[model samples]
Target: MKRLMLDGPGALRWEDAPEPTLDAPAQALVRPVALATCDLDPAVLQGRFPLAGPYPFGHEGVAEVVAVGEEVRTVRPGDKVVVPFQISCGACGPCLRGNTGNCAAHPLMSSFGLGPLGGLDWGGLWADLTRIPHADAMLVKLPDGIDPITVASASDNIPDAYRAVAPQLAAYPGAEVLVLGGPAAPSIGLYAAGLAVALGASRAVYLDTDPERLSIAAKLGAEPIEGAPAERVGRFPIVVEAAGGSKALIAAVRATANDGWCTSVSVQAKDTALPMLEMYSRCCTFHTGRAHARPSIPHVLDLVATGRFDPSPVTTRTVPLADSIDALLEGPVKLVATN
Candidate 1:
């Protein structure tokens, strides 16, 4: 088997590895049909958030089940599925409460492409084959007609965008949403903008310097603003900070309305001080955590199946799965690599 391995900062390559298999009663073996890079992949490859050398490298994918273990009843061989980024047992207490990202049955960072974290260690999914533990709990079956590109990022970004804005909209229908988008996790912010409009937000405003991202947001029905995030006006009730910098977070916090909610998906490699006093003054309900993708994937898929949310437009580049490592280093907004 071949998998993408990060040798060091700004280094990536395909490495030979043992073939993955159904190692447990609830596991399954899958052949990745399509793979997408997460917000962290580029940084990891670029040496921004440095990790140990030669670690397995990707986390998002849509795959075809090639084999299944005895207890896997929810899906069968030949079914195409979306594998959530987090590994969790559905029976765990935290999982039952919709907090599947930190399942008690799995160690911290118990996920694919995240190497050696003291658990049933799995390698990257950007390989010829991969293993899926607790398949019944971890996999979401794709609808019959859904395109792989359409649901490729559902394992993380799509569902994440759903969670970030859904609750706030539920609390305040037609609420305003503000997104600070940049190089890191641009799709997340773009997705949030599209979802806000679809869910009846009074206004969805996207602030970014990238013309490509701003255009995508505009096409998605959001009002795109081109400038620095700090150069903003009034406050918004719902905000998503995904630009991945201290300034972006600061700007997001400053632009949030009093008693508003902000969801930040940026993986801050280093600790940076925030304006705690300002957030305190606004009574802001700020949230920053790993996305619990499994619990919300089905709903996101339903939205895709019913023609409400389409992730296809976000994919601006496509390449063979074998060339993923090189494509990633090139750094396109939403690149999909298929088998």
Candidate 2:
């Protein structure tokens, strides 16, 4: 078997590796059908993000179950499923509470694809085959008629976007959403904007300086603002900070309406500035963390199945898995590599 390995920034190569087997009763072996890059992958590949390398290279994907252990009942051979990037045991305390990203059964960052941060050699989806533990808990079987390419990002970014607004929109029905997008990984911000509209936001306004992203957001049914956000953007009840910059983060935090929720999906490697006084005065809630992807994937899939949320528009292009290395290094807004 062969797997894509990231030697370092801008340094990706294919290397031979032993095929993964179903080593546990709760495990399953899958053949990736469609694979997508996580929001930070492009940055990591270009050396824009600081994560070190020498790890298997991919995390988001939908796959076909080729084999399953005796204990895996939820899915069987030939079933198509979405694989969450994070590793977790369903029986663990954190997983029971829906915090699968922080599952206690493994190290804090146990997951796929990510190098040192991923915490284990669980392998990457870019390979011809991969092993999935806690199969019943981690795999979300794709609904009938759903294309694997459309929901390939359900493994991570889509749900990461879904989490930014779903709960807040539910809390404040018909409220507006504001997304501050930037050059750094625009897909999450775009997804959030689109999902806000699909999930019943009265208005989903996307602010970004990039014309391409603004146009995509508009096509996704959001009102696009083609520039940076001001100190506040009309007090949106649901605000998402997907633009990976301190200034954008501050603007996103300040834009939260009184009692509103602002979620930052950007990976802030260092302590950054925020409008503490403004946030305090507004009494807003600020949330920033790695998404607990498993719990949110079902809802995202349901949305895709019902024709409510379409992730295809966000996908800049789809390439054969054989060409994934070059396509990934080139880094479009969202790229899907199929087997």
Q: What clash pairs does model 1 have?
A: none
- Provide backbone clash counts, one per model: 0, 0
Cα lDDT tens digits, model 1, 58-152, are 77889999999998999999999999988889998999999998889877768877656423367777878888888998899999889987788
Model 1 worst lDDT run, 10 consecutive residues? 114-123
For model 2, residues 1-339, the per-residue Cα lDDT tens digits are 989999888899999999988778999999999999888899988888888878998999999999999988999999999999999888889999999999999899889999898964788889989999889989999999999999999999998999999999888989999999876658999999999999999999999888889989999999998777554558788899988778878888878889889999988877887878888898889999999999999999999899998878899989999888888889899999999
Candidate 2 global TM-score: 0.98
lDDT of 1 at 9: 68
- Model 2 residue-pair collision total: 0
CA shift of 245, model 2, Å: 1.5
